[model samples]
Target chain A: MKVKVGMMSFAHLHADSYAHCLLNNPRAEFVGIADHDLRRAQQKAEQHGVQAFDSYESLLASDVQAVIICSENVKHAPLAQMAAAAGKHILCEKPLMTRLEDGQAMLTAARGAGVQLFTAFPCRFSPAFQQLRAMVQAGEIGELLAMRGTNRGVNPGGWFNDPELAGGGAMMDHTVHVADLMRLLTGQEIVEVYAETNNLMYHGNFDDVAMLTLTFEQGIFATLDSSWSRPRTFPTWGDVTLTVYGTRGVIEMDMFAQYLRHYDDRAGRIRQVFWGDNIDALMIDEFLRAVAGEPATTLATGEDGYKAAAVAIAGYESIRRGEPVKV
Target chain B: MPYFSGNGLSDTCPRRAGNLSSVVNLLTEDAMVKVGIVGLGTMGRQHAEAYRQMPDVQLSVVYDRHMDRAEAFAQEFGATVAHDLSEFLKGCEIVDICTPTYRHTEYALAAIQAGKAVVCEKPLARTLQECEQIVEAVHRHNALLMPAHVLRFFPEYRTAHQLVKAGALGTVAAVRMRRGGDFPRTKSDWYADFEKSGGIIMDLIIHDLDWVRWTLGEVERVYAKSLTFRHLEHLDYTLVTLRLRSGTIAHIEGTWCDPGGFRVSFEICGDAGMLEYDSQQMVALRVARRAEAGQAGGVEVPESPAVENPYYRELRHFIDCYRAGQSPEITVEDGMEAVRLTLAAIESARTGKVVKF
Candidate 1:
């Protein structure tokens, strides 16, 4: 039987993409969506041709075997806990939760309830990244020495700009993706983080530009530019680029560069029409497979999410203390 | 003209007996400014080539502690060799010092003390103290000195600077610059000695550091990481994050680990738009040759032809400033500041902490 999956909320911008993935994945049954704001839920549900539940609790009470927690950064913990309590597997968003204690609590709830808690890090499913990982594993680039990554994007000015809801700013929102990728590629944990954050673009309280230097456990170092520095008129959202330097060779990967550049005078801007694999759908397929009792080796677990988020959390602390902090 | 010292021809001038005619020709070219080059290394050779291309600048004299190397260079460039430091100083009105990091302060101080305009290679000196010494000598003697921060002369970087100055990208938010290549193979491999060259952060990323300070404003703080401490053989890499006083964050990466050859790239993002340039993407020609059966392969060199070489432009600009008796765009103070910033970055990398200016 197909694994039945629902979405907990439409509060995140990725909720629409996840909803579309669920509807299109052949091995999963797309269930309804639930949100605190019924109108927003209803709008997304109707647009995706799915049912809209009035509340998250009602959605957890349904027959869905799993639920993707697509709520705001601050609400990920509670939603995942509720889903875990209802015996449903959970696929929480990028940051498993904003706070360390909340992430630990969510992991504990899932483990005690015997349900899987996967973190949504779709960049792991990128084909280019997959090839990069395989090559690195195969010793294409010999003993890894250093790495540089960037996940810069245009500012998504909504609840993301609200520090309380988003937990932090560009450092919090964008650091996790590349952080997770680094973990997956190196199989090492980030031990220390030094960061510089500024909001020069918008001059707001939330930072729109962040630069981080991360030190790994084995003495390897990497620098990450996790900034919302792309302008509104940029061709695409931004870029996910990683250049890994090893003893033997160097590999550069631009995850979303397989696109046609389209300049439209009507829209008064240039746009990138992507022709790459559906990374979100690939992630959802892995989630469903894990839900169906198959091994999902590539899926980002709750611990991976916590570790990546810890890097960003320590980044903020480093910025506060004006020094490098241990992660 | 007091610094000219009569076409620099003296009894000590080491012009070969067979090359007397060339020496006479060099002395008779009164319209040409006599230029002397010190150190026969890669940068020294590049400066000689640039001076050779300038019709109004005569490659008058050459000097190196190794007399054989200086003799060979002087013969090829149609110039006389100077065996003595004081005689070399007297031979040319402009002294281009392209020695290693440790010797920059020595030559620059000597040239400035002699009242000759000086064009010294980047990293004006090895340390802040040395850079300050050169700056002080320039002030004490009222001498003209220009640090050869050649990135300011590259057309691509110049365009980016101009665009930002013209507000093409409104309210710059961030900048990223990268430069790297294989470990340099020099005559002495002095670049491998961190004490002498200060690793990649000092010798390499100082280019971007100066460019960023020029385009952005003063740096408030810096955090950096590098493999210089690892003591790896023939490899070094560093990444530095700078917080500009104008609130812009700049990340600069410098590497000596890339085996695929040299690459330079930068991205500037602002409120209005973004500008990106990658040297690998701007290749106009590439040549690849197959390796012999038992030999390792040769590296494919990609060439991007420019209207004028940046080194030529930099030397030309310095010469023009010397002729006009005006301070150069890159003053001795600016070069000292670049050294200060680079030293700060090196400190941050070693201490693993944020260094505030």
Candidate 2:
């Protein structure tokens, strides 16, 4: 039986891409798109040739086996709770909620409803990361001492800049991806975090640059450079690179490395022509497999989302106190 | 080409002045300024060669404590050998102090006292107190002192700074600079002594800290971690994070690892755009689109015009400023600021705490 997937909201930027993934996936059926903003819902539904629903509740109550919650960050907990109560599985965008309590509540509700909740961490699906993980598991590098990672991208403005709508700026939007990756690679919880966050780019009320240093309980240390430092004219978004420095050797991987350099006077600069495997498609495939009751290893649980979210919030506290804070 | 006396060094500066005699039309020998070089090390030899290329600056004398080395260097450059520091300072109107880091204060102070313009190699001195002393002496003697922060003269870095000032990349969000080289195997092995050379953070990454402050703004705090190869014998690595007063954050990586020959790269990320430069690249400045819409789009690789060696550019700037009675691009205060940040980095690395400005 094919998994019936309905999108909860069109508020997040990735909703359109997720809609395409659902429609294209062989094992999943695109049920419909729903949003409180009716025009957004209708526009996205029309673009994807799917049905449009006026409210998230109406769509959840329909014959949907799973829902992808791509609502504004502040709306995540409420929508996920309702979806859980309706007995539908969830695949939510990163930084699941602004508050730890809210993320915990969402996870609790999902657990009580006997439904799976997958957090969106597509970096786990990158082939480069897969290779790196295999090497680490095989002790290609001896005892892992430190890992350095960066998820720098161009700033996505509008709701992303608004603290109320997006939860935070670069620190929130960019941190969780690498945070989840670090947890996955080390298999150790981040016990302490120290961060330096600032608004050097826009000088607006939100942070555009952040550097987070995480110390794990297993004595592994890592630094995450999570900033919206890429320019709009940058070839692609920024990159997701990880450097695993172990006692024996070092392994460095750049996730977006498979690209040709293209230069034209029209653009007047060199741009990366990406022809790599679609990581997002792979991630969605894994999520659907898990939702369809197949044992999938790459699925990021709601608890995974909670841990990463909680670490980011603690990073903010560390920034405020001007020191490292316990997670 | 007439030298434009501002940031437009791109237009008039020759990309390749390696064959300096072929490019320059010399002024009358008597009308030229005479310069003295105070050491005969790698940096000292480069300064001597760069000075020899200048039509209006005469490479007058070369000096080193090791007589044979000084004699060899002077013979190659056709400069007279000064047996002592006082002899070197006597006939020279300008002195380039390229001695070991610890010896900078002694030679610079002597040159200033002799009423000569002074060009000191970077880190200014081993400590902040020494830099302040040099600054005070320059003020008291009314002398010109230009610290050789050569990155300010590098064509790629200068272009990045111009773009930043022109609002081409919007406001800078963060900066990451990397500079590394094989261990400095000097005559005395002074570079290996942390007390003398101030290790890699002081002697090497000082250039980056100065450049970052020039590009971003004043640094407000610093945190650092380092790895020393067997108590910093021949290799050392440092990673420093600097928070600037303008809210810009910078990651500066410096190493004295033996493998990589010598490499430098920087990426300045702003609100609207980003300017990237890697020394390994043929075209240095890769200016990206404004930050908006989807992710950053097409990039523009500005033609990295060949230019005079940065060392030559810096020396020329000093000589031109001295002749015109104008201040240089990098002032004593700027050198002091770079020093302050480096010292803080060292302190932070030792204490494992963020050193606030």
Candidate 3:
């Protein structure tokens, strides 16, 4: 029996990738797409050769067993709560929700409905990160000491630049992936956060640059450069790189480094054509396996998303107070 | 080349022998500027080589507490050895203080008081207070003082600065500068001691700190993390984040722990375009040698050739400023500001707080 999955909205850019994952997964049935903008829903549905529902309520009332939430940062909570009330599991895009209260409400609603609430953190499925975790766990780099990471990207200047829809700027958009990865690597909670955020690039009210200093509960510290600093002419979208310093040695991981440099005269710019494993497909497969009553240990849960979002939330507070704030 | 024009020499040169016309005649007749070097260490040898290449500069005296090292250096450079600081200051028209951080204030103050032009190495001094003393001495004595922040003379860095100033990358948002190498092994091993050398932040990353301040504006705040408090033997690493007054964010990483060869790189990201340079990728030449039997493999050395050496350019600029009776491009105040920013970073790392300027 294939698990039926519907997508909630196409506000986030990741919705297209997730839709393709569901269509390609053999154990899953791509049901339909529903968005407030019916034309967008129909357009995407026509592209995928699937049904288009006029309202999210109609999609919820369908026979789909699970739904993927890919709405804006602020809409994750309401959409997921509605899905849980209708007895459907959820795979929400990160960050799980914009505010802590919304995250808590989502977790409570999922628990009350007895449905799985998984956060989509595709980086956990990266082969490079998996090897790094294995080496560190196997005592190849000794005790963990510190780390430095970067999750920089070119500015996505749509709803992402709107402070209301995006919750914040680069700090909200980028910090969670690496924050979740840091937790997964150290197996510790972040205790404190100090951040410096500015909007020098665009001079918009929303910040385009954010530098965060995170201190873990286990006495380890790290810095994250979560900035929309890459220009439009960059070879690729951006990068996720982490350098782990330990007592005995160091391990560096560039997650999306498996690529061929394509210098095309036609395009008039260099480009990186990625040939790495499709991490989104891997993450979707894990979610389907869990729906099929199998264990998914590597999956990021609602709590993991909540903790990572808490780090970013504290980062904003630190910026306001001009000091480090405890998480 | 006509090295010294002797125009406006009477106002700045305290040891002028005669009236303006006679001084001009004397300078044009014999344009050799006698230069002295103190502390026969790495920098002293480097400055000696640069001076040897200049036609109008004569290396007159060399001094060090270790007389044997000074004697060897003077013999190789065909210069005389000064027995004491007084003799060294009297023998030269220009004094280059190449001593370690702890001795910078002493040598620079004495050179300034003796009314000789001074070229002091980076960091200015070990502490901000010591830097202030040198600044005050230069002002009080009306002496010529130039801090050797040689990154300004490096072609790559200069190109980057010019591009940013010219708005090649429009409204830069963020920058990352990295510099690191294995722990330096010196004769006294002072670099290993945090108190004496101020570790990597003061001794090494000050180069980037000064460059960023020069390119951008004043830093409004600083936050940092370092392994200096860990007390790891012979190893230090630091990461500093600076929020510039113009709102550009700069991240600087300095290390004395990388065993792989030295590396320097920078990335500037702006709205219109991006600029990136990595030393590891820009190598013009590389040489690798096979290991002999019963011997470890020889280390590979990568070289990137430039039109002119940055150190030579820096010294040449200093000499021009001295001859014109004008201040250098990198003034004593600029050196003090770099020291202040570095010290603030160190304080932030030690206290785990954001330090404001």
Candidate 4:
């Protein structure tokens, strides 16, 4: 059964790119698109060769089984609720919900509608992450131990700058994927978090840099760094790698950068380097397979997204109190 | 002829003991490989000098922001000066980025794009994403990037890594590394600012993160406590605790506030052995254990002057990688991991809390 997919909007910068993936996907049929902004929608539609509709209702009612909501961060939960109520499976862009209750509300709606709700936290599909997970599960590495990971990037202002629209800046948008990956790979619920988030990078906007230290249920201590404040020229899409120290062996996977190669011809020479994560295509492919009901790969379930939301919100909560939050 | 065939092991034939010249003789092959320096700042110059007059390699050229510096470096090393970025790159097959943190990406990217192999200083990039972009560029262009986690190439760290990898310490039970030093004061006004340099933890302690991760694997969580006081006043000093996916615990105490002096050391305690490493102290393996007959557990030490300068080894590895079209020892991905850990440390520091890995 082919999963017919429709674009909910083109409000986010990466909306068109996500639509392009669907457009090229075999298992998922690219239906049509809907956005409140007609001109922008039409422009995106024309660019992607998909039909554009002035109203979301028209687009939602089209013969599509699911909708990938590439809408604003704030609208995610509300729109997800609506799409779910309409019996449509939802694939929404992340930070799940800026607020914990909103994430729960959407989760409730999806559960009540008896449909699947998939949140995008693509790092879980990175090749390095896959290898890490394999090592952890297979016990090739040994007893679970303390580890550290980082995912920092330069600011992505635009709508992300507006607190109301994007919920939080880098703290909200960036931490979700990493938080989700932690729970998925380690199988440990974060029990406590001491974190600090600030806007140390882009000239005193909302805080876009975040540092989080975590104590998991198993007493596995770890740290997750997610900032939109990375200095511009540091190579490889902001790094995300986990260093897993086990009883038997230690494994380090630069989920995004182990396969980095570049040509340095300073001395008439070409150089090759491996970077991190060879899983963007694989992740997208996995998403399609999950949508197609292919044994349901462990994705960012509403639960997973919800956990990230809870922890992230709690991180903010702790930040406000200048204290640590025990989960 | 390069004698690059080191599987890093004991072959039942014990060579001469505790001698630098003998060590060099034992290690080198017949040919003196040509090497070049890119981004001729302090590191570029140091690496150039490190490689100059070496039995293993010859200094080919030096490239820098200032053509005069490049020329001066060339004069000093009897090498060539890259008149421009393109020309300099064309003359040297080996490129090193000692550029400021911000310029790291551009210089590295340009070098890689020009078909040269590279060795970059830490943090890969300010962001994991930038590292990923560079990594992608490397893949698309077929280039090699060896992010210099020079500590890994150093004799002490190399030995420690071997013991850990060989299970010298049964299974790694815990790790703690401490590094404290006064900030350079003025790499730039940007270094004074936390944004560009990523503060002391990202800029300095990150050395530990790279080495620890290199020794361990992935971290499951991080609980960090940090402050910005004393040395550099505004620069941060941090203590980060890491839990790996394998349940091994680790901690790092880092500071840009070392008013006393520079301190660099790490201790790895496994089930079997407890090992320690400090550059200022001992450059060889120092393991301590419970001694019999009321003699407290004392360090079983290896003799010193293990003077294998890892920075030079790192650059040589980069050169070998570039010349051979092989994978580098410390890759961009490794840099990315270090970047990610740096960000996570910042996150933990910000919230004054523990963070999920």
Which parts of model 2 have CA positions greater than 4 angstroms off? A38-63, A135-148, A186-189, A198-204, A213-223, A243-252, A260-273, B1-32, B56-58, B65-68, B80-93, B181-190, B228-235, B255-261, B283-307, B324-326
Predictions' DockQ, in order? 0.71, 0.47, 0.58, 0.03
Order of models, best TM-score first: 1, 3, 2, 4
Model 1 CA lDDT for position B150? 88
Classified by CAPRI criteria, candidate 3 counts as medium
Q: lDDT of all predictions, in order shown?
A: 0.88, 0.83, 0.88, 0.69
What digit string (tens of lDDT, one per residue) describes model 3 on residues B143-213?
A: 89999998887777878887898899998889999887667777788888888889889999999999999
For residue B223, model 1's alpha carbon misses the true position, in angstroms, by 0.9
Question: Per-residue lDDT tens digits of candidate 1, residues B1-357?
Answer: 222123212222232223344544665467689999998888888888777766678888999988889999999999999989998988999999988888899889888888899999998999999988998899999999999998887778878987898899988889999998888777678888988998899999999999999998799999888988889998899999999888888999998888877899999988787899999887777768886697532222223565456777678778878887877889999999999999999898888878898
Angstrom error at residue B189, model 4: 45
Taking all chains together, each candidate's TM-score versus the true structure is: 0.93, 0.84, 0.93, 0.52
Where's the lowest-lDDT run of ten residues in candidate 1 chain A?
A94-103
- Looking at candidate 3 chain B, the ten consecutive residues that score lowest on lDDT are B1-10
Q: By TM-score, how accurate is candidate 4?
A: 0.52
Superposed by TM-score, candidate 2 places the C-alpha of residue A116 at a distance from the truth, in angstroms, of 3.1
Which lDDT tens digits does candidate 1 get at residues A208-322?
Answer: 9999999999988999999999888889998899999998889989999999999999999889999999999999999999999999989999999999998999999998998
Q: Which stretches of candidate 1 lie over 4 Å from their true place?
A: B1-28, B285-304
**Which stretches of candidate 4 lie above 4 Å from their native place?**
A258-280, B1-357
Residue clash pairs of candidate 3: none
Estimate, for each residue in A1-327, the C-alpha lDDT of model 2 and write its tens digit: 888899988888888787878888898899899999999899989999988998888898899999999998989999999999999999999888789889989989999999999898888888889899999989977777667789998888889999988888899898898889889988899998878998877788898899887878975667788998887678877899887766556676888999998886797887998888877788899888888889879978999999999888988898889977899
Per-residue CA lDDT of model 4 for A1-327, tens digit only, reads 667888787887667667767766677677788887888888888888878888888877777788888888999987898889888888788878888789889989999998788877777777667767887899876666556666666566688888888887777777777778778878889988766654434535576656677768966667676666443333434566566544455565666555545655664543335544334345555677766767558567778888887777777876786567786
